[model samples]
Target: MQSPFDEPGRIFSNKRPLEEDYTPDTILCRDEEIDRYSEALQDVIEGFGPNNVFIYGQTGNGKTVVTRVMMDHLQNETHKHDVDLTILEVNCNKHDSIFNVLLELVNQLRDPDDQVKDQGPTKGYLWNTLYDELDRLGGDVLVVLDEVDMLGHDNDKLLYDFPRARKNGDLENARIGVIGISNNHMFKDELDPRVKSTLCESEIFFSPYDATQLSEILDHYAGLVFKDSVLEDGVIPLCAAKAAQEQGDAREALDLLETAGNIARKENADTVTEDHVERASDRVEEQRVLTIVRDQLTSQMKLALLATTFLNIDESAEPRAKNIYQVYKNICKTCGYEPRSKRRLNDFLDSIRLYGLLERDERNLGRAGGRSYIHTLEVEPELVFEGLEYDSDGDDSVLNQAGIVPSPEDTDQYSLESFGA
Candidate 1:
C-alpha cells in the first residue's frame, strides 16, 4: 500500500536506535565471546546430556544478552536436528519461591483457558501438570533462572528435584538443563553441595569490559542510537571510560550515551557533546547510588537516614550518633511517630552505612581510652531526606524547616553551610 520512493528511502535511510533497543543479533562486536558460548553448548545441541551452566559477571558485561542470543541459536539448531527443545527464562528476583516459579512455568505452558489462567491450580497440581506437559513434549528443556542469587532458601526444592527428576521418576520423557545467571559469584557456595555439583557442570565467566572494549561497544551503538552528525568526536570514549572505571558494565555505558543524547535533545542542542555526557554521567551515577540504597533499605532504616540528615542540617547538633538520635527523636515527635531506642538507632546507622549512604570511622577517645565512631553523610543530606520521604509519611513541614526541600533553580545543590558544629 506504500509508494516505491517511500519504501526505497526507508530501507536505505539511517535509523537512529535507542541504546536499550539493541539486540545481540545486531550486536556488532564480541565475536570471541559468541564463539566461546557456541562451543560451550555444542554438546547439548548434539542431543547428548543437557548442560547445566553457571554464568557470572559484575552487572552487565554482556552476560545476559549473550546468553539470550546463544540460547536462541541453540534452540534453533537443536530443533533442526529434530530435537524437541523448550527454553524458559525466569527472573529469580520476582519468582523467588519455588512455588511461584512452578506457578510461572505452569502459567507459561498452560492453555489460555479462563479457568487455568485465573483460578490456577495448587502447587502439587501445577507440578503434576508441568511434568505431564514436559513428558508430553518429550524433549530437552533449558531453564534459565536469571538473577538466581535472589532464589534464597526457597530455591532448594527445585534445585533438588528438577535435575534428578528422571531417576526419581518425576519425569520419563523430558530432560531439563538449568542455566543459572547471577551477579553474585558466591551464590554457588551458599547452595547445597549436591545442588552445586549438579548446577556447576560448566561455568562461564564474563569479565568486565575495559575502556577500549567499552568504547568499541559504544561506537557500534552510537551509530544506531544517534543521528549521524549528532555525536561529537571523543564523546563516546569519555562516556565509556567513565562507566568502565566504575562498574565496567557495557549496558551502563550504553545507557550513559543514550541518556546523554536524550539530554542533548531536551536542551535543544545541535550535537551530543562532552558537557552533555558529563551531566548525563552525574545524573546516572546519582540515580544508580540512590537506587541501590532504596532497594537495600527498609522504612525504619530510611527514617534513620532522614534523622541523620536533619542532624547534619541543624546548627545546634553535630553529625555524631548522639546528636543524630536527638534529631531523629525530634523528627519522629513532629511527625507524630515514636523514635526507636538508641541501640536500634545504631543498628539503623549500620544499615545505612552498609547501604553506602554514610561513612562511619572508629577512633579512640585519647584521654578516656574508649572507642567511638564519627558518622558522616556521604551524599548530600538533602537528597537523603527527600529519598526517605518516598517511603515515609513524615510531615512536609519537617522537610521545609530542615531545609531539605529542593529549589527549582538548583535541584542539584545541597549546601552543608547549615551543618551543625
Candidate 2:
C-alpha cells in the first residue's frame, strides 16, 4: 500500500485560511468597522434590547467576516453571564424566498421529531411558527441574513417583518435582532421606506481596503498558509498590488497566493517565486473569462462568439453585427451545428455586449442603407479564443481553418464570399 515515488513536499502549511468561510482568528485591517459594528450591537450586550444592523459594501469587503468575528466574541461574553443567546445565520443566496427562509429557520429550531417538510406552510403560518419557537427559546436571538439583496425574490416582506418581530407581538421571550448584509447598494434604497427606516437604523458602510491594507491581509494569511520561509520576496507584494487595483479584494489576493503555491507544488519547484505569481495571475484571468463563456453561454452562442472573434482577428472584418453574423453562420457549419436565425443570433450578440465580453456601438449608414450595430471584444481576442479552445473538447478544426493561430501564406486564398456563406 506504500508508494515511495508519489511522496512530494507541499508549499502550503494549511489551505483553510484561503477558503471563503474560513475566518482567520485575527482579522486584519478592519478594526474600525468592527468597533462600530460592536457598538451597534451594544444594546444586546447590555441586556436592554436588540438592534437592527444594515451592512453594505462591494464584494470581498470585510462585512460578513467582521460580523462573524464579533458574533463569536459576543456569544462568548454573553455565555459568561448565563444568558441564553442564540445565533441564527442564513445566507439568503442559499435560502432566497420567504418560505425557504422560514422553513430553514424552523428546521434549525424545531425538534427532530417535529421536523417540517420542504415546503407547505402559508407565509403567515410560517411567521407565526417562527415566533412561537423563538418565544419558547426565551432568550436573545440574533438573525444574521447574508446576501440580503436576494431575499424574498423581489419582495421585502420577510425583511420588513424581521425587525418588527417584537413590535408585531410575534415573540414574547426571545428578543430578535436582525443584521442584513448586502453587496448591492441599491437594495436599501429600493426597499419600502418604512422597512428602510427601521432595517437601516445602524448602517455601516465598509469601504474597500487600500493597497497597504490588502498587503497586510496578504502577509497575515501568507504566514498562516505557507511554511516559515518558503515564500519568495515579491509574491505577496505583487498579489496585493493586483488585488488593490481590483477593488482591494483580500480574497482575491489570497486566491492568487494559493494558486501560485499550487503551481509551485505541481511543478516540483523549490520555492514559490514571483514568476509563479505572474503565471497564477494569468491563470486566474483566463479562468475568469472562461467561466463567463462556459457557464453563461449556450453551445451555439459560444460558436457565434468564436466566429466573431475569428472575424475580428483574422479578416480584419468590419465589427458590424451583420458582418459577424455572416461569419457566425460559416463557423456553425464548420462546427457541425445548424446556424441560428439572424434575429436570434443578434439577440445573443446583444447579451454578449451586456456581459461586457464585447462592446457595441450604433452605426449610421447612408440614406440607402439602414442603421446597424458594430461590436468589439472588450477582452483580448486571443484570450477569448483561448478560453473557447479550453472549453471545446478534442481538436478545434474550425479554429485552425479560421487562422486563430495565424496561418502561413497560401497561393490560393479564400474569398469574402466563403466567409459570408
Candidate 3:
C-alpha cells in the first residue's frame, strides 16, 4: 500500500524519541546506565540501606533522563510493597540558595494555607520548615538535585544536610538519600570534605555515544520522525557519522536528523537523501555558530558583530573590526543606544574572538612595510547578523561618518588573519 503525499498528517515519520518526547517507557539504548542506577536505588525498597549516588556526564548524556526514569521506577516498586517513598527533584540552577530550595520542598509538603512567604526571619527559618515537613512526612525520602554543582562550590551545606540528616538526628523517621547529578566531573573534586562524603557514596559516569551508538540512536529517531518514503537508506548513517566525528553527542545527532527532515519537508521533497543532509548541515552549522555568537555577546558586542556582518554584506568594505567598529558606532546611534567607548569596544571584540565569531591578527610588515594588527570576521557577516537579530538600515550612516565610500568593483576574499604572529 502506497501512502499519498497530499495527506498532511502522514507526511513525515519518526522512530526516535525526541528530548521532549522522551519518557521512561520510551527511552532506549542505555541499558548499562539503567542497571547501575537501579542497583544503587534498590536498597531503599529492600530496607537494607539507601546509598547516596552521584551521576556525572556531559550535556544530553542521559544523566537526568535515566535518573528520573530509575527514580520513578523505584518509587512505583516501593509503593507496591507498602513503603512510603518520596522523591523530590529540584533544578539547582533555579533553586540555588538554601532558603529557596527549602521553601520549594516546604511548599511541596505543606498545604497551600500553611505555606508562608513574607514571614521571614532568616534562611534558618526556611531550614526549620524543611525539617518540619520531612519529619511530618515521616518516611524515606530521595532528593534528586539536578545540576547540583551550580549551588556553588563552597555551599556544600545542603549536600551534607540532606543525606546525613537521618544519621545526624535531624529527622527520626525519614531516612533521606541524595542523588546529585552534575555535568562537571571536577565538581566532586572541588566539594568540601563533609559535602563530598555525603554526596559521593556511589558515582556513575555516562560516556558520550560513539559513531555506532549515534547511528543506532539516529536510526531510531529517523524512523519515528520522517515518513517511511521520505528518508533514503544512507541518510541516517551519514548524519550520525558527521555528528559523531564532531562530538559524540546523541542530541546533536538527533538535531541533525530533525533539521535535515525540516529542510526536506520545506523543499516539498518526497525522499530525503545525502544532498538534503549536506545542505541541512550548512544551515545547522550556520545556526550553531550564530547561537555561540548570540549567547556569548553583550549588546555592544552584538553591535560589533552586526557591524562586521553589514560590512561583509557590502561589496567594498573589508571585514575588519576597526572598520566594523566605525559601522558599529553608527548602528548604536541609529538604534538610539549609547555607544561603548573604543577601549570597552576592544574588550567586546576580544570577547567576540573568544566566541569564535571573529579573528584577530598582527601583520608583520617586512622593513618595507611596518607591522600592524588587523581584525576580521571568521563567518559570514550576513548570517552572523541574522543570528544576532540585528536589522539592516538603508542609509549609509556608517560611510558618511567615516568619510569612506564603497567600491562596487572590489573583488577580494576575506580571511581571518591570525594575530600574535
Candidate 4:
C-alpha cells in the first residue's frame, strides 16, 4: 500500500502563491492605488512625520495587500535615510475593543514573559501604559489597525486618540500616526467627527477588479503555482469571468482556480480543464453558502431559512410571506421553541435575502389590494438542510426532531395549504 503523502501531485507545483496570506513578489493591475498609497506614506520616509491614512474597499479588492506593499516600501526607504521608525500592526478582528487593542499593542512592544494579562486592567491604565511605552520608544511610530470597522463605534476612542497623541501631550517623546483599513465603505461616516477628521487625513479607496484585471491577476498566480501546461487555456478566463460577474473578487477567482487544480489532482487528470473549474465553482459556492448559514445566521434566521427551503422543495409555486410564517410557526412548535411574530419573521426573511440565500419579489394587486412578497430559496434544498442539521451546541437540531428531510421530488409530506394559509 502506498501512503497518500508519498504520491506527488502533478497539478500544483507550489500552493503558497494561492493562499490568502501569501504576498506576491509583484502586484498586478493596482499601480494607481499603489501610487496613491505611496503618496500617503511619503511623509513617514521623508522625516516630516507620519500621516494617518484610511483605506476603504470591499473584500478581495487589494486593500490589505496594497497597505503591506506600501509599508514595505516605506520601511526600505526609511532605512536608506537612517530615519528612526517603528511599525506596529494589530488585526482588530480578534482584538476588537479599545482595551484589547491597547493590550495587544503593549504585548507586541513588551517581551513575551512580561506581557500583560487579559483581565484586571482598566482602559485608562492600559492607555497610560501604552503612552509610556510609545514615549520610551521615542520616534515616529505608525500603527495599523486592520479590519478597523470591527471595532465599531464603541471602541473608536483609539482612532481619535492615537492620531492626536502628540498634539494632546499623551506622548511627549514619540509621535503617533494611525493607518486604518476597513472593508466597509460606510465605516468612515460612522466614526466621530473628531476621529474621522484625524484618522481620514488621507483616504484611499480600492475598487473591485474587472474581468480583465482578474484574468491578469489569475494568470500571474497560476503561472507561479501550477506546473507548465497544467492549466487548459480556458480555465483562468472562466474562473475570472465567473468571479467578475458575481462580485469582481480576485480572491474568489484565485480560490476558484486553486480548487479546480485540486479537483484535477484528485481525479488524476494531467491538465486542469473548464469542466473541473465548473465543478469547483459549485463546490466553492456551496462551501460559502454553508459558512454563511452556519456561522453568520442567527437561530431564528436559520429557522426562517429552513422554513423557506421546505416550501421551496414541497410547493410548485414560490411561497408567500403568509405561507412561510405559518410553516415557520409549525417548525418552531415542533422544535419546542416559541416562534417570533409574523412581522419579525418577515424581517428575518429579508435579512436572509441580503445574505444571498433567498430571493424576494414584491408584487401588488390592482384595485385597492395591498402588496404581497413572494419568497424562494436561492440555494438548493439539500444545502440548507445540511447547514441547519447541526446546531452550534453540537446537539441534534430542529431538523432531526421534525423528521423533515429535503426531497424536491416528494412534496406530499408537507404542504403550504396544510398550514391553513
Candidate 5:
C-alpha cells in the first residue's frame, strides 16, 4: 500500500505564489495605484523627510503588497544616495491598544535577546523607550501600521503622536513618519481631527479589481504556480468572474484556483477543469460566510441575523425592518435576553449589510410619505443556520429555543406566527 504523501503533487508546480503572504515581483493592473504610492514616498528618497501616508482599501486589493513594493524601491534609492533609513512594520490587529503597539515597536527595535516583557511597564515608559530607540537609530524612520483601524478610536493616540514626535521633542535626532493601512475606508474619518490631519498628509485608495483585472492577475499567478496546460481554458475565467461578482477580491480568486488545483490533484486528474472551480468556489464561500457569522458578529447582531434568516426561510421573501425587529424581539425574549431599541436594531442591520451578509432595498412610499427598507440574506439560509447553531454550541442553540433549526427541507418546522409576528 502506498501512502498519500509518497508522491509529489501533480497539479501545482509551485504553491508559494498562491499563499496569502506571498508578494510577487511584478504587480499587474495597479499601475495608477503604484504611481500614487510612489509619489507619496518620493519625499523619503529625496532626503527631505518621510511623509505620513494613509492607505484605504477592501481586503485582497493589493494595499499591503503595493506598500511593500514601494518600500523596497525606496530602500534601494535611499541606499544609492547614502541616506540613512530605518523601516518598522507591525499589524495592529494583534497589538491592538496604544500600549501594545508601543511595546511591539520597542521589541522590534531591540535585539532579539534584549526584548522587553509585555507586562510591568506603563505606556509612558514604552513611549520613551521607542523614542530613545528612534533617536539612537537617528535617520529617517518609517513606521508602517497595517490594519491600523483595529486600534479603534480610543487607541489612536499613536497616530497623532508618531508623525509629530520629532518636532514635539519626543526625539531630537530621528525624523519619524507613519504609514497607516486600513481595510475600513471610514476609519480615517473616525479618528480624532488632530490625528487625522497629521497622519493623512498623503492618502491613497485602492479600488476593487473588476473581472478583467482579476483575470489578468489570475493569469499572471497561474503562469508562475501551475505547470503549462494543466489549467483548463475556462477555469481561470470562471474563477475570476465568480470573485468579481462577489467582492472583486483577488485573494478569493487565488484561493479558488488553488483549491481547484488541489481538488484535481486529489482526484488524480491531469487537468483542472471548470467543475473543480465551481466546487472550490462553493466551499470557499461557505467557509467565508461561516467565519463572518460565527466570529465577527456580536451577540445582539447574531440575534438580529437569526431573526432575518428565520423570516427569509419562512416567508420566502425579503423581510422589512419592522418585521425583522418584531421577530428579533421575540427571539430575544425566548433566549431570556433583552432586546435593543428599534433604532439600534436598524444599526445592526446596516452593519450586517456592510459585511455583505445581508442585502437591503428601500421601498419608497409615494402617498405614505416615508420609505421602508427590506432585507434579504445574501448568503444561503442554511449557512446562516449552521453558523448560529455552532455559535450556540450545537443542540442548546438559542435558535432551537426559538423553534428555528437547520432543516431547510421542511420550512413548516418553524414560522414567524409561532413567535407572534
Candidate 6:
C-alpha cells in the first residue's frame, strides 16, 4: 500500500503562499504604519488635493505590501464616498527613463487599441495628453512610482511637475497626487530642493524588522506552508537569526525556511532540521552570487572575475589589477573577443568591487613604491568558476587550446573551485 508519489515527503502543504509575492491575509506589526499611511491617503475623501507621499526604506521592509494594503483601502473608501479616484501604480525599475515612463502612462490611461510609440511625441506632449485624459475622468488621481530612484535624473522633472499640473495650467480639472517610494537612502539628498519640497509633502520611513519581528513573520508563513509535525522547533529560530543578522529581511528569512523545507523534503526526511538550514544557506548564497554574476555582469567583467578566481585558487599568489588584466587579455584573445584598454579594465574592476562580490584592500609597499590594491573573491571560487562556464564560448576544444582549462596532468590534484588563504 505504499504510495509512489509520497517519497517527495510531506514537508510542504502549500509552496506558493510562502513565496515573495504572496500577500498575507493579516499584516502583523505594522498597525501604526498602516494607520499613518491611511491617514495620508484620506485626502481623496475630503475634496482636498491628495498629499504627495514619499516612502523610503530598505528592501523587503514591507513598503510595497503596506502600500498595496493602503491602496486597497483607498479604492474602497473612494468608491464609498462617491469620489472619482484613479490609482495608477508603476515600478520605476521597469520603465527607467522619462520617455519610457511617459509611454507607459499613456498606454495605461489611453485606449488599449490606441497604443503609443516607444519614442512617441515629446515627453511634454505625452504628459499633457495624460493630464488631459485625467481631467476628462474628473477626479482625484494618484500615481505611485515605486523604486522611484530608478528614474534617476529624470525623476526631478517628473516629480516637480506631476503635483503642479493644475497650478501650472496644464490641466483644467482633476487634482494629481504623486507618491514616490524608494530603497536608496541617498536618493533624497541628491534631489533638487524644489523636488524634495514638492514630492515629499508627507514622508514615511519603514525600519528593518528585528529578529523577534522576523521570527513572528516566519512562523506565521511556516505554519501555513507546512503541515503539522514537519519542522523542528529550532528551524524557525535559526532561519530568523541568520536573516536578522544579515539585514532583518523578512523575505530572506522566509526563503531560508522554504529552502530548508525543500532540502529536507528532497531527502524524504520526516521533518526539516537545522542541518538542512545550514546547507540551504550555503546553496542560497552560492546561487545568489552565481545568478548575479552570470546574468548581470558583462563578458569583460566575467573575464576579470575569472582572472581573480584563477589567482585565488593558487594560495601563494596575490591577485592584483595588473594580474587580473593580463589574464583578462588572455581570455579575450582565446575567445576571439577584442580586449579593452587597461583604463576600461580598471573601470570594470571598480564595478565588480562595488558589487560586493569581491573584496579589495590597498597595501602600501614602501616609501619607494606606491600602493597597490589586492583583490580577492568574497564568493567561493568554485561558484565563480562554475558560473564562468556559463560565460564560456560553449566549445571545450577552444578553451583547452587557449590554456584556459588546465589538463588533468597539469596539476597534482586540483578543483577549479578550491581556493587558499
lDDT of each structure? 0.69, 0.75, 0.69, 0.82, 0.84, 0.76
RMSD of each: 8.7, 8.9, 9.9, 6.6, 6.0, 7.1
- Candidate order, TM-score descending: 5, 4, 6, 2, 1, 3
Q: Put the candidates in lDDT order, highest first.
A: 5, 4, 6, 2, 1, 3
Off by over 4 Å in 6: 1-9, 290-421
Q: Which candidate ranks first by TM-score, i.e. highest?
A: 5
User: TM-scores for all candidates?
Assistant: 0.69, 0.70, 0.68, 0.74, 0.75, 0.74
Steric overlap count per candidate = 1, 0, 18, 0, 0, 1
Q: List the residue pairs that clash in candidate 6.
A: 382-417
Q: What is the alpha-carbon lDDT of model 2 when measured against the actual structure?
A: 0.75
TM-score of 4: 0.74
Quote the lDDT for 273 in model 1. 91
Query: Which of candidates 1 and 4 is the stronger one according to lDDT?
Result: 4
Model 3, C-alpha of 284: deviation from truth (Å): 3.2
Q: After superposition, which runs of candidate 1 have C-alpha atoms over 4 Å from their true positions?
A: 1-16, 19-21, 26-29, 114-122, 289-421
Q: Which candidate's lDDT is highest?
A: 5
lDDT of 2 by residue, 1-421 (tens): 7753423556777878777679778987888888889899887777876688999987678888898989999999788867678999988756756788888898799888998888667878888888888988888888899877655224467888877878887777888888999866767776888889888889999898888888888988888888878888888889999888876767667878888998888887779999999889988766666656754455666776766665565554676777888888877776667887786676567546544577777878878768988777778765665555544454554445545332223312434456563
**CA deviation > 4 Å runs, candidate 3:** 1-7, 14-16, 19-21, 24-26, 118-121, 285-421
lDDT of 6: 0.76
Candidate 1 vs candidate 2: the lDDT winner is 2
Worst 10 residues of 5 by lDDT: 390-399
The CA lDDT at 172 in model 5 is 91
Deviation of model 2 at 67, angstroms? 1.5
Pick by lDDT: 4 or 6, better one: 4
What residue pairs clash in candidate 2, if any at all? none
